[model samples]
Target: MNYTVNQSWKILLPLSHLSPNYLHEHQLFQRQTGKSFLRKIGGGMDKFPISPEILRPTIVFDNEINKVARALGLKGKRMPYETANGTLNVNIHYYFEKYIVLDVVFKQRISFGDISLLQKSRLSSYPEIESLVLAIAGLIVSGNQQSYSPLTSIPTIRCFSIQSLDDNQFSNMELVEALTGHIEPTQRIIDDVLARNSGHQTSGPIITLIDKQGVIQFIPNKPKLTKDALQKYSSCCNLLELMLVIEQSIKDGHLDSNNVFLSALKSLVEKPEDIVKSYTAQRTIKQYSKDFHLESRLSDLTKKIELASSVLISEKKTLRRGWDEFYASNDFFQVLFTALVAGLVTGFGILWAFLKGL
Candidate 1:
């Protein structure tokens, strides 16, 4: 059965450097603003005041920056970036008048097969969606440089929520399978809060699955507070350097499904330790490549693998493994296996001839 998966990615970027005036200069409005409040903290009531002045500025862009502004694809509407297996719609929101929140939706129809395949879909879509986000970041950086001061750094966290495009009453097992691609126990975490507030009951429990990558959550079908929960758990995931690398890859026209970035991501989801080991090995090899005179050979091989468009990325791994096994076989065993395979073919051919004669 084929099911549609709707993966929602929310990138909450804090721009402390941006002000209402700056947003106004860019023809952007304060979508959200802070409010004054009084609260008891450490057994004392404290008051906090915030400016409520709303800024709505008509932006006048110079010729040089106008190109960058246009490149952002923000014309007061959502822009769609197509991926190999899905469509990603992007919209920018200035939240709390301080953060540039990117609301992105990736929709794809996938054939429901093995649970492992579900994980594959989720993993593969990330790089595609990430590339689009990085492209947007690169554009924002350019726009900021020309129109104002450049952004100090890229965001470090990624908040993601995913669900099937159906309203079926999700079973706990189903939720566990979808969230982590494994069948496991899921504990309800929001029952107490739900009991206190009946209004929040329909949103379902925020089930937490502590993964090495981060805290994974099996959210409710409603997805009302999933974003917030994910944000809280995903704060420690730093992707600054990764953002820069992908952004530069996008600029160099290497942001494709077959890129090493996607390969590394898939490997990360399965064997995270292998990724670390591979990185360490690569660093060691690079340090001694000149001494071993292996730099040119490694570079040439890498370029060949990356540039080969004839084979799909999904098959490349299997093909390489096959070749690796074949080359690792003993020379005598290789010849023996080849002869056995030839004998089988010849036997089949002779049998067919005999059968036709009879």
Candidate 2:
């Protein structure tokens, strides 16, 4: 199936590796940027222009670019440079401030035959985009003398695609499964959205969910829509760390165990909504740690995984016992049929003997 997708790369910083004081300073600077720091960075609050040279296939952050970054903090939000294929929008953690996101809006939406292939080529096919991301990261952490290294930050890719449907092409369930790669517990949400939008003459339904790799949103082609109007779907709870562990387990040849763990997790949740809520509620964020104590959170998740494994084993045993009883009943019927047939044959022989004697 072909899809037209809008792609973006989110580069998340390794918060654990950063210094507490450095983070605090950045926070203060961000707060003060509107009042005092704004004046300090440049003449006033205005958009800076990105260098055209950086748009070249091979980007080198020359001394001039470094000088500008040191003074202005790579403050530009728009990419003045454009390619025939698409235009780029670079945001330095504009909303979440946790990472930098490079959004690619194609002049004509880019086409892909397969989602997996598109994901794999996200960085490789666009070398210049990757270089631009690294350059921006370097520029952000350039002048700081803190022990934290920007190199620790790695970029993850996400994409939103639009696939138009023919009249009565597929049912809602089929469409949802096709778009989301069959991520469980999302169908209910999609149904709710579809119900809400029924009878209203508008675009098709949008389905979004978190897959094994990252978030995937399927949107109909609605041009000229504002970003604020966009309906972004996400897991209600922070299952990111849990997902990472599952992915790693698959890499280590624990696929069967992971499957059981996931199945148990789904079974444990009585309602679809519960799937979004965290497994545990006692988690609290610390002052120094940006990830809310990652190690501790992982340990908590580990306990849930163990519990899920046990539940799966119990279910398997129950299934086996049910099958055993079914087979045992069939065996009893077989034995009864054999005894009845032998008795009939003996009676027939005795009757014949009596008639001959008479």
Candidate 3:
């Protein structure tokens, strides 16, 4: 809530380090990377790509950034910094696998009164600091979709709280809760087009990362797969619920399944518009499956026709060639005609002589 953030969170995350360890203990941290497990199953597994939201970059002291990063957990990554009024101010840039990207902005603000924050004010469910962390985590998970199968990547949206009390650009920082669930561009740019070999990659070899942008590689997937497996398989429920969802999309001229997929994906992230950018893979799959079936049928028919034509043509050519070669020297038709004429002449002469003698 705006009532409290004006004074307190400065000592909350970094100085106190309360949220970082909690982030690491998350079960998602227990999952393997794309390279390790992806190779074993090839393209078969659907593991979540979401990295733990706990990223604590090295904080620098004594004018050297390197020393600070090693102290925190950043073994060897460069620090993000900006020059203001001839002074170099550095902040921790924490990136997650699927959810969010955020800078642990450390600012120093002068204390004013006993203004500890309004004790009686109700807190808004959506808080800015929590929002950034959640957003970045969503990004990393959605980024490496090839690892997760049909489970879609959550979008990366950001929210941040200033560690310093100075009333500068950090002054009117708006309060937000839904990280990737909401829209904020300062926190949403993705690194794309990871390359491999010269053989023209189809959809392979692209890097799987989760940045602030929504699910990157393909269309974001639907969340219906999350419907309780028990419900999905139970006779009390429609055993073919998913099957009908697919069948209707194809034969019934209905795009309902696709809409559901999109709706659920949008709900996963804070941004409603990001849903539009995703490919309607479910719809495309339905349409393409039908096309593939038709094409296969056509291909089989064409092959049969070609085989018949080839057999008929081969027989005709063989007969013509054989006749030409066999008759080349014989001339059987001419011999037969000459023999018939000689027989008739001989017969007539004999008959005339006999008649004259008589």
TM-score of each: 0.35, 0.37, 0.17
Where is the poorest 10-residue window by lDDT in model 3? 3-12
Please write out the lDDT profile of model 3 over residues 118-172, one tens digit for every residue.
Answer: 2111112223322333333332333321232221222221222122222222110
Deviation (Å) of 292 in candidate 2: 14
For each of the candidates, the C-alpha root-mean-square deviation to the true structure, in angstroms, is 24.2, 23.7, 24.7
Off by over 4 Å in 3: 1-53, 56-100, 107-358
Candidate order (TM-score): 2, 1, 3
Who wins the lDDT comparison? 1
TM-score of 2: 0.37
lDDT of 2 at 111: 43
Clashes (backbone N, CA, C under 3 Å), per candidate, total: 0, 0, 34
Scored by TM-score, the top model is: 2
Q: How many residue pairs clash in model 3?
A: 34
What local distance difference test score does each model get? 0.41, 0.38, 0.28
- Segments in model 2 whose C-alpha atoms lie over 4 Å from true places: 1-4, 15-81, 94-108, 111-121, 144-155, 163-205, 221-229, 233-358
lDDT per residue as tens, model 2, 1-358: 3344444444433222332223243421232222221122223211211101112111233332333333433333334334445555543322112222233322224444444433432554565555555555554554243322335335553443343322212245543453344443276856753453233212335544333334444555344432311323212012332333333333343433444554433322223222222211111111101132434534445566688889999999999998778668867778678889998999999999999999
